[model samples]
Target chain A: MEKPQFDLQQAISRSIQDLYEQGTITNSDRHELQAHLEDSAEGLITTGLSEEEAFLIAQKRLGRPELLNEEYAKVNHNLRTDKTWALLLAGFAAISTFIALISYSGSIYYYLLERFGLSNYTWPVVAFLCLQSTLFLFIALKKREVSNFLRDQVEMNPLRSIVFSFTLLALVKGMQIAVLRYLPKSFSYPASTIYGFQGDKLIEFATYVSLFCLFVSLLSIFFSLRSPTKGTWRAAFEKPSIAFLMLFGIGTACFAASTRSLSGLLPVPMHFTLFGLVYLMGAALISYYNENSKLHLFFFGIFGFCAELGVGVVADIDRAQRGIGQIYTPFFILSLIVGLMAGWYMGNMLRGKDAIPSR
Target chain B: MKEISKELMASSLAPIILLILRRQESYGYEIIQEIERLSGKKLAVAEGTLYPILKKMEAKEWIAATWKTGSTGKERRYYALTQKGHIELDSQYEQWNFLHDLINTLWKSPNLTYNRL
Candidate 1:
């Protein structure tokens, strides 16, 4: 077979894409460079050169990805990569704000659970989760709103971004508390173990509900940094069916087999702790796509921190407060950094096996 | 005519770009062509490296750019000088004039020129 002739247009596109992937150029930068390349080639062609020759010369003159990247990097001092720490700080602030909100609203939720003649505090939360999941699924099917919402988030001023985000968080928790708190103050307490969990399980139910909601928010922030796509769910490293199955299976298995469980570590469950490992791997699996971009696994930190907050909520309900060790809080962050570095390495390796070229 | 040193060519690009944009709005390729035309091809710019300079100047607010459709129906990033750019160009012109006057006087004095060389 004769050697294949490469399409120079495609070659230039690939080179520009490489520049983007290398963080030498952004989407707009790629557009600008692509326009430059085409214009340069056209000018060359008008000078009596053949199209292929023009393209070859133009492409050569445009320089290598590494060189272009260095030049662009020198110019683009405000690149998002420089803001990684700042974004991580914002995530941490949100997590702290969430923890405080849950604590502040605890008494109100407890009172309403008793006042409504309701023995089931958790059923409402389960209902909320079901509703949220339904909306997510609908959005996934429709493939529009989640990405549009995230695009709006990226355009938000980074300073005011955190304030607006936490306000939304406060509004959500506040409204729920208000509805439950202000419900007609007349009914007697019920004596039933049906529907969701009974009153005795209230604390556990609340902890999980709070943790789930916090994770959803952290995930939103994390995914907000991604290139806008159709739905928030698609940014998921693994589909929930796969991730939940894998995580739930491993969690259940470990929780079942553990000789000493649940108490010695204060409030941290062996099962959810297992989820940390599973999620880190899941995080690693997707890290390749975000590798050259900003936030470099800091969102994994956010996700991990969300899990760590579960410990706080549970420990607050327990006889042993502050749980585990003196530096338990720091440990959560350490897990984030260490876990992400490990996962990022693993993800890069996984990326190497991908048929599509790494971005 | 002797070619300007590439190092000199590179250092002087920012002012030249500012000057060209001050004339009217132009995109990267057109700016390069304009620079080449004015220099009579004596100043050979590394075309690939010009963009980063443009980008840097844009970042500094010396120039502003917008994507516009040209008469040829092609979209190009047309860059125009900003108020800051005008101020910068004036400042650069004054500095260049001072340097040019200093060099002229030095050249007129044979002993000083030879000693400096």
Candidate 2:
């Protein structure tokens, strides 16, 4: 009696169905299996067994399909739940640092305003130094935890995160200064006097700080983009660097144009535009950094948006009371919407469903 | 015929598992038995190692599993190949075969001796 010939196609089809029924094979896996069976069919057919037998034999040689399915499922679940928590913690820590900065600002400003008087030439200088020091200290203290948390959340590259964050900060501050310069005289308040420094001295000091930040940010970006280590820094610079650079350049040009048009004095629109650009970029960067974790994006978006909005509202409220009109409302709404959308989109794009390696 | 390292064993295990389920849905013991029989008892995977790999593959969306009542009325998790698993197996097999053939060729090269008196 002759043995029944093996039907490779039927065997593969049956196996695929069984796996699918078992919840082992997903849609993507099904497609992959079909392709594999097609490729291996010829080799199986060359064996003495019929096409089906050969395919079955080849598959048997491949191993137990259930084991692979189970392992993959376990890894994905851990990443989604456990890894997600780690990312959230990291994001919270980052947000806390920003809060600490705001706290420090309030403390310094009030302390200087009450003690040395807001008009004292030395108050702004002292306040600025104090604020910078406070921020630096807070970051240094929380650096390790934040870094580890960030590392856990966004697996691609570490240096990229650092570069992205720093670059975003500089771009934001630079735009802010340019906008302030271009705003109308009515909007112009002596920022230096508000802080308590001589206007010329405050401007010189701010220029130095901004220049330093820009240089450091650029260097970090270069290393991150070109790094062979493939750390977070590298990942951070991968896609967003182009967008960031483009926006930064355009922002600077707008600032310069506004300044030049207004005879080197900054206008209110320019200031608003700069703040909008910075806030949007910062939110976007945070979203990108925490791409694997949605909670981070949500928290950062809310906090950053509210902060910018509060500032805009306060700046416009005085004018509103006097019936000078609500100029800041439209810009404020537009900025908030754009910032939120960008952050949300970036977060989603980064948080792909692909299985990452189990740590 | 050399013993496979843990990493190599782990990587190759996915294809081996898929091939077994192609015939019929099988529980852990039966699949293990089949692999032992096919490999001529050269491969004996511990339960701890085997279970983790199965879970990982499932997570990757490569294969699927379900519990079935055994003859003794106890539930046993049976796994089978999904379409994706089949494709992965084929690709992995091709690569494995290519590498195996290349290694074999290198191993079987004639001794480099010429015109010795």
Candidate 3:
């Protein structure tokens, strides 16, 4: 008896069904595979084989369906476990946040009571901190499993990571501003008993701190964009744009200068001179880092040190007169904007051909 | 007598399957027998190979399958071509024809001269 011809379509249909049932291939993947199989079958038939023969031959060529299913299972497993890791990290972060809040409150309360006649409110502030810590710890421990499971689901979408990081920055900044507002005026500058320290100076200090924090946040954003597949040292090399470093350096200088001046009895003219020097030094550092020469790093170090010295001098000048003033000026604004733009440009340049969108 | 590579076979299976299903809805055993008869026993796909492909295609919505009672009262899965499968068949047929024409032109060139001549 002649051997009956095999139906290639029947084989392909069965394989797809098996894969889907096994959770090896997604619905869309099954469709794509079917389309590919159809083309392969046609090619076999055109090569002088009968339809039935072509179908059989095509099936053999497609390789072991079980092996493909195994590969799919491995990928799915990795996705599921990675989700667990993300959840674990989020839990740790929440606990850390609670701890940071309690520490912040304690420091603020102590400073307020010691500097002003605000000892009556210390217990209330301490109670509030304790309550916050208790609530955070309860939530962290009780919902650990649920949080991990939910994190697993959320981590599948990349955009969620960006939103989570932004939310963290917002929370940190909010807490910092709140702490600045509630602090006693005398704690700001004790030596300036001749002239009372206003809340405006505290606000100014908060603004400088916020700007510095914003610069660091941008660096974090860049790092998030360029994560390596694995390993700690390899990960650090995936730095953001050079512009980020420059902006951060200037922001740090401004913050340091303003804070020191607020505490110190600095002369107004000397403080202004120091501020001008900070700009000049920051500009030099930016120029040095931007250059593509062998001496670029050396120049960067020299200029960065100069910038630090300039900020230190300005703070000293402010301290000499027991005065506090604005650290941000038109030059600071221009440097920040220019640095951000340069960083973005450099980042895009580094991304190269792959960065171009398909459409 | 030489066997084809697995990659080539895998790539060609889809069109062959679609073409066969276009003829009529058929069960696995019958389809296997038909293929063997048509190929003159040149290609013999193991049961392990054929079933997975069938399941995969069915999952893709390119074909639909139903379990029906065979003449022996045994249950057998029958599969039929879907509308998407038909459209895919047309597109693949066009691509195959283009490739065939290009290969024929390249291989059967009349302007070639032999070294002996």
Candidate 2 TM-score over all chains jointly: 0.27
The DockQ for candidate 1, computed on C-alphas, is 0.53
Q: How do the residues B75-94 of candidate 3 rate in per-residue lDDT, one tens digit apiece? A: 55678999988887899889
lDDT of 2 by residue, A1-359 (tens): 99876656677777764454343333444444554455445555766666766676656654566665565465444434443444444444444444444433334444444455553555566466556655554443343333434443244433455455556555545554565465443333343223432233433344334433444343333332222123233244334544554453344333322222221235656645544554455555545555443444344445434544676578678788889775665664565466556655754565444322111
- Count clashes in each candidate, considering only residues at least 3 apart in sequence or on different chains: 0, 77, 61
Q: List the TM values for chain B, per candidate.
A: 0.88, 0.82, 0.83
The candidate, 2 or 3, that scores higher on TM-score is: 3
Say which prediction, candidate 1 or candidate 3, comes out ahead on lDDT: 1
Q: Give the distance in Å from residue A137's predicted Cα in candidate 1 to where it truly belongs.
A: 12
What is the lDDT for B11 in model 1?
A: 73
Worst 10 residues of 3 chain A by lDDT: A225-234
Worst 10 residues of 1 chain B by lDDT: B108-117
Candidate 3 Cα misplacement greater than 4 A, ranges: A1-245, A251-304, A314-359, B1-13, B16-81, B87-117
Candidate 1 off by > 4 Å = A1-31, A41-60, A65-75, A78-156, A175-359, B1-6, B37-43, B55-64, B73-75, B82-117
User: Candidate 3 at residue A314, lDDT?
Assistant: 75
RMSD of 2: 22.6
Q: All candidates' TM-scores?
A: 0.48, 0.27, 0.30
lDDT of 1 at A309: 62
- Global lDDT scores for all candidate models: 0.60, 0.52, 0.53
Alpha carbon deviation, residue A7, candidate 2 (Å): 55
